[model samples]
Target: MPVIVLEARDFSSPIFLVRTLEVISGCITFSLVASLEPPKDPSDLHPTFRIFCMFIWCFFFTLTLLIHILSIIQFHSLIPISWKNLTVTTAVLGALMGLSASVVFPWMVIDHQGSLQRPVAAAVASCITFLAYSSETCILRTQAQEQRGYMGSNPGLLKILQLWGGCNMIPLVLGVVQSQWSALGTPSGVLSWQLWVSAVLYSVCVLMSLVTLVVILGDFAGRCFLPFDRFLAGFSLIGVFLYMFATVICFTKILQLKEPGNRASAQMTELIIMETVVASITLLAYTVDLAFSIKLLCDRSHA
Candidate 1:
């Protein structure tokens, strides 16, 4: 259903409609999985229960990795750019970025069981996510710069989704780090520094997203989109949407369960959602307008 909900919009409306229907059909799938475990009674449950919850959590996380890989392929298909006949480097980086998380989960959860290996694995994954995204963003900026004088229709939607999708991983990285910042109920978990560091880091991710959106919008407005291009605007807009949506989902889930341990988590969640929702939704509207404009550009070219 998560796959279908997102897949519905990538291309033809009929295809999207089919995906939407499929998503609806899978409501039972989500509910069934969610209902499997008894609700956590925060006061009574041992910390081990959270580990059990995390084990079940891997299935959904795997789906996200799948989505990231799919977005990479789809975005690559949209771009005219390439690497030795391969599509944009962005796609390649995205594939690696997705793998980072996929690998981290099994290594930390199944193989090592929160032993020394877990933190080591997570730190490696964090570095991979960060490097992949930053490298991909640099590639995109280069692509736009190379096409500086050659104006055509804005970059295709695929490129937009790919690039921004890669760029959005920083927030994912932060949230993941925060979630497993330490081995809970232990000295590491009790440490104030870890929570404060994560709070600050995630907060930075949120601010970076806002900056990215603003820059993308300004590019469309000022018509300076050479590297990332105006079409990247839609990608940026979608990135913002996913960022905000994920932020909200995380906050709501944590709060509903009353498990966002530190005061920082609660305060940061509120701050992020409030600002991100307003900015992202507005940019989304602008992106739709730009998409229609792209159609006009295509029509004129055909004419």
Candidate 2:
């Protein structure tokens, strides 16, 4: 008889340590949000913002916690794990945490009402948290690429994800620019030229997603190096949903901005909703797609 012994090694991975810190940061932010008093002024701030912030914080906290637990299991040799999938998840978490750092400011405003200290500290902590996760992602990715020839399932889907990811940056960058320079004040309503710009950008995002879905599906057999599975379809659908929702939100915000009596507080609320929804969905879609692809790669490696 032959004996085979498998020892778990995930805890020794540097990525595991980074994920632990990320979870801690999420918990700190979540606790702070929970302890804050309810919004005093309904007109200036809505309860929904606080509720949304809490939801996001909780989501991040729970996700990291679960991932950490799974890592521990894999480390103990209780189960096998895919390093590539974990790396993708970490990369996605880094993106979401970066967005979380930005998202905290609005909640800070509602919670602290002009105090700079608490919000700044939280934001800095969140930023550092993302940086740590990002560092881990880079390290894992470098290691993977060194061990494996390339990181993706096939050249085709990899190209699509790369292009799609790059295109997404367009909206992200433009939104940042618009927010920073928004005080210059553009025209409102359908007459708002900036509104048209937003409309066009989001429209492109939608069109691109749609086109990607069709192209990937129509020729999936020929193009995919891996099996054409439901995961690919699900991932493509998420992309489409993300772009469609973003397009609708862009138009809605334009209309809201044109409203005669719309308060600045209301505008800020709308912005928060839009940014949070878009960022969350985008991060989720990317994470799932990469995770599935990585799973396939892991299967190959195991085989």
Candidate 3:
């Protein structure tokens, strides 16, 4: 008689491998967009739009890459939380960002029935990456619904949150309106549909941010720093930062133009750089905030 034993594979290993593939795909996408030749005609896809799209892909991909690398290296254990849960969340985020990139990269580059090869290729690559990340996330996921009640009677904290939100929203609303007006008035050199989509999304983000602040302001008896609460707070703050960034970029563009018909050529480089910097910061904030919230949730569940 002989006895045989089977060893179970580490579930986290698959998550790390999928994330690595996502990182590689993201790098490919960044390279492809970065190397794309600028359209010669002003009526074609604007270079600024391309630059913006590229920065977005770069930002998310970079964050996804870094966090997953840390997870793979077991660095996430430094936090007082379960590493598997964090890995699952990171994978989920990677999948979502991959989906966004798939659609946006192609849409941003499509113009005048020109060559769609690059965009198509990039979209396919990202789609595959998305599928991989999503599958791994599902595998590592636990049966936890992320929900939290309202905060306690903390008026001071509520006021501070409201004040901060108002400051962010005021500038953001102004910027969104300004950008929308400028694009509609001068739709020739801009991505018309993209501007419209951006306006709509920005409007929604503003409303959500304000609504979350209101939720925080309402009095209820419970711990406010719950995982889901942190999630909402973090999401609102990220929206505020993004909106402010948009405002700054729009105002800069407005300032650069000398007249109605004149375009701002010299400011493109600076604006692109600014977008990269702000996007990096926003993504980092989002990742950390989301991670903390999940960590808290996992801890509470166990307790």
In terms of lDDT, the poorest run of 10 residues in model 1 is 148-157
Cα-based lDDT at residue 130, candidate 2: 64
lDDT string for model 1 (1-303, tens) is: 223233435545432333233233223223333333333433322223234323323433343344345543554334333322122332333344334434433433233232444444443443444344444334444555344211211333323333333333334334434443332333343334533443453454455444444454333434444543334444445544554554454444345335545434432344334334433443453456356556656776699
Candidate 2 residue lDDT tens string, 1-303: 233332456556677778777788777766765655566754433354455455655766686677677555544233343444434543554445456545544543545445555556656665665676666656655654533222223433342443334334444434433443343355345435544555564555456555544454343344655465544545445555655555465556656656787543444445535554554455455556556656776787799
State how far residue 110 of model 2 sits from its true place (Å): 5.1
Number of the top candidate by lDDT? 2
Better of 1 and 2 by TM-score: 2
Provide the overall lDDT of each model, using Cα atoms, as 2-decimal numbers.
0.39, 0.52, 0.51
Estimate the TM-score of every prediction. 0.28, 0.51, 0.47
In model 3, the clashing pairs are none
Candidate 2, overall lDDT? 0.52
Stretches of candidate 3 exceeding 4 Å from the true structure: 1-12, 42-49, 79-86, 112-115, 142-303
Q: Write the residue-wise lDDT of candidate 3 on 199-252 in tens digits.
A: 554556546645554444333214455554555656646655655555455454
